[model samples]
Target: KKKVMADTNVFLDRLLNYDKENMKESTVEKMQPYIKDKNFRPEQVKQVSSALVGLCQWVIAIEKFYRVNKVVKPKKETLGIADAEFNAAMADLNVKKAELKAVDDRLALLQQTLDESNTKKQNLEDEFSNTEKKLTRATKLMAGLGGEKSRYTMQSESLGEVYSRILGDVVLSAGMIAYLGPFTSNYRQELTEGWQSLCKKDNIPGSERYVMANFMGDPVK
Candidate 1:
């Protein structure tokens, strides 16, 4: 506002100078028309420059106030600001590709983990099948009956070896990376202790162990 006053005052002085400086013909002939002009004064130029600068500053402040305080906020697709919003949308789209690629990497890693877990589970199943085959043969040889026998009732020393193998065989199962040992041995206890240490570090509770254990170890019964 002060700058506007200064500029107005200078412009008024310019109009006044034309009347005062009208000189003799010899002096007027010696003077350049450019030098005689009301608009050419240095003070007049500064005043106009200041007023323009002030006007620009005021316009910028109004624009910023409209942006922040929002006396009237435009929509996503506003009339005059579409170019600005379009550029922002394109920038977001450019960023989204990298974000989606990171998600894809995580999904790929999870899929590989799942596949490895399944393969290990299949190997455990094969081990179980082999153990069952051996137990069947031992039962037939011990009973001398050419038929399957109850594992619990037979209790012979040689067949007990097969029972111990069944109890101690390393096995794998679904949804876990670590392998575990048999049902009747301390392998499960070892695994539990190790996992407890890990879970404690991670601040997870022990109740999840039942599910995690069954997933990591062979069945108990």
Candidate 2:
């Protein structure tokens, strides 16, 4: 109410001091009586009341315009602050998203490495298993062949003994073949016995109990 009264007084002072030269002539003439007198006569009481009502309406309209502007001005500033805060929040959110993506990428790399390591471990295990199986089979095969070793060893030793006597056997065989083919059985036997006796006397190898029939492979004897 006080503010309304102040605005009313200011409006009245402006009306009293209004420049008549700038105003229209008809408008100045119509307002000149009220502006000069500042007091309403009994006959002009209704007009004065009407003018006061118009002045109050104008004051109210002006006050409302100023009040609306006051409210809008601060709201505009608040809106600017709010827009800046929103932009900053969005920037923070984008940074967080980038960080999350980096973390996800790192996690994927680690998972891939772990998978590769697992594959290598599996391959090593398979190789070890296969090698172990081969070793087991080889051990079994060697064990199975163990029984023949002694017989082979004895055969080797017998062959070595036969090899040592080969020279003496060859000499006796050659002589018998050259001399015995043309003789009668009794003569051949007699000659072979004499040759055997001579060989034993000289301590020749394989001559101690030599048999002509056996050496010659003669089935008739």
Candidate 3:
């Protein structure tokens, strides 16, 4: 029991004094002496065996920790890269959305312009149709009045000729009335016809077929 106690105290002392940075190597170096010493007693062998088992367990635990960290570090780096990529993608999507909104606004403006133009075009077409209809009606009216216009022109020319001869005709009729009052009806008619023939030869204006009886005869007779 005393030897076991001594061995345990020596083991604890060695554990405390060993290099912490290279724990596995220092612990193995310290235990190597006991393993190779074949002259050790049963208790010493048992203690050494127990220490080796514990050392193996520590080494395994440390190795597992290192392996887990190695794998987790790369995974963390990959996750960071993926996060950055996701943020970039989201930013690009936002830009594209803004562009699409601008396009939609432009399209709406263009549509408004097109609608206004169409409305203007329709109004112009309607105005043209009305103008064409008015022109057609005017043309037809002019065509229908063609003969009446010609007749009015002839009447106007005849009145102008009569105006030129009005004074001469009035004097001749007055002279005949004063000179022929004492004559018989037959003599009056003959004299009036002769005067009318002479007036026509002189280009005087009067009735085309003049008769003295028709002008001065009484309605009661």
Candidate 4:
């Protein structure tokens, strides 16, 4: 996810600037926060997150093993045990400790990198969210400022916009999911339509995927 932000930003820059040759979906993910924005596609973000999670788990395990190994010490030298036995334990523990120490160091570096990456990702998500809200509010506020175009009601707007209009909608949604469980029993078509209307063809599917929607019609929902 940390890499996701840098890579996605680079990709977006390239896309907006028309650097088409190297912009590859297989290599990146357009973070979920920007799924509704025409500037990015979420499939790229899903790919990167899935790949990085496996790598992160692998590195975390290596770190744990190293920490466990560091606590081990050579057997007592004064033991009446066989000379060969002492030699074997000393040799084995030394090599294992060294190898584990190296792994531990590597893990520490990776962890630092991951932390920095997460911070950047979080920043990007916040920016993406806030930008969406501002745009939505501006749109709605603009409509109300003029004539009765407000009659063109949407159950919702682009995620960026909808979130802006509904204060704490995202936070509330998180609460609903975490505390109340899945919002399966009661669903609204207008909600579905509003989301659909807001989403461009490229990004809609990605946002819909985060929630397991039992769609009524075309699977596109």
Best by lDDT: 3
- Predicted candidate 1 versus true structure: per-residue lDDT over 1-221, tens digit per residue: 56745688685565445332233445434444535566645456557786454444443443344445443444433744787877888899979988999999999999999999999999999999999999999887887753344544565765565444332222212212444533434766666566666655665444433444443457665
C-alpha lDDT of residue 2 in model 1: 63
Q: List lDDT for all candidates, in order.
A: 0.56, 0.70, 0.71, 0.53
C-alpha positional error of residue 82 in candidate 1 after TM-score superposition, expressed in Å: 3.4
Best by TM-score: 2
Winner on lDDT (1 vs 4): 1
**Sorted on lDDT, highest at the top, how do the candidates line up?**
3, 2, 1, 4
Per-candidate TM-score against the hidden true structure: 0.29, 0.53, 0.47, 0.29
Write the residue-wise lDDT of candidate 4 on 120-189 in tens digits: 9999999999999999999998877655444443433444464443333343344445654534545533
Clash counts for the predictions, in order? 0, 0, 0, 4
Residue pairs in collision within model 2: none
Q: In model 2, what is the error at residue 171, expressed in angstroms?
A: 1.8
Which digits, one per residue and each the tens of the lDDT, describe model 2 over residues 90-112?
99999999999999999999999
Measured over all alpha carbons after superposition, the RMSD of each candidate to the real structure, in angstroms, is 33.8, 13.1, 13.1, 56.2
- lDDT for position 148 in model 4: 44
Identify the superior model by TM-score, candidate 1 or candidate 2.
2
